[model samples]
Target: MEKQFTLRKNEDFKRVYKKSKHYYNRDFTVLVKNNGVNRPRIGFSISKKVGKAHQRNKLKRRLRSIVYNNYRYINNVDIIIIPKKHTTDFTYDKLKSSLGHVLNKAFKEKKINYVK
Candidate 1:
């Protein structure tokens, strides 16, 4: 994703984690908050338990690509994605499906609308 659509600051992450609710699944944990911006912002977190630096970086790249490609379905929210240890066990398609499912669930629960 572009820098403009990315959640970069520590304070931004803390605010979302502290104030918003999250969706948890076997692959990932998604923390979401309405940012009131025209576009959504996203951040990714991969713990050491998941992998080393190279593996973590690769996972982040994959996630960024997935989110960027599906940006149309994302609304004006701040989404923080924390991958679980077993995330890498899945293929890219599986990961993408899980992420999409989680996001769709959150959007429905929060009554947020996104462009199809």
Candidate 2:
């Protein structure tokens, strides 16, 4: 993901965590907050409990790829994605579908709006 579309600061993540509405699925918990920007931004929070460093990095990469591919569907929100322990067992397709399901649900509920 581009730097401009990724949340890089601790404060930014904290703000989303504190003020955002949440959406969940078996593999991930997503926090969504209106950013009032022209584009969406995303952050990942993979804990040590999820796995070793390399595993966490791999998960982040996969998620970034998924978000990049689906960027056009997301609106102007700041999102923090927290992967559950079960995610370590997921293949890329599985993870992508799981995240997509939660995002679709969020959009349907109007918790997060979808762009064209």
Per-model TM-score on C-alpha atoms:
0.90, 0.91
User: Quick one: best lDDT, which candidate?
Assistant: 2
lDDT digits (tens) for residues 1-116 of candidate 2: 78999999999998999999999887889899999999989999999999998899999899889889888676688988899987987899898888888787777866553322
How high is the lDDT of residue 57 in model 2?
91
* Top-TM-score candidate index: 2
Q: Which pairs clash (backbone N, Cα, C closer than 3 Å) in model 2?
A: none
> lDDT tens string, model 1, 17-81?
89988888777889999999999999987789998888888888888888888776667789999
TM-score between candidate 2 and the true structure: 0.91
The parts of candidate 1 lying over 4 Å away from their true place are 110-116
Off by over 4 Å in 2: 110-116
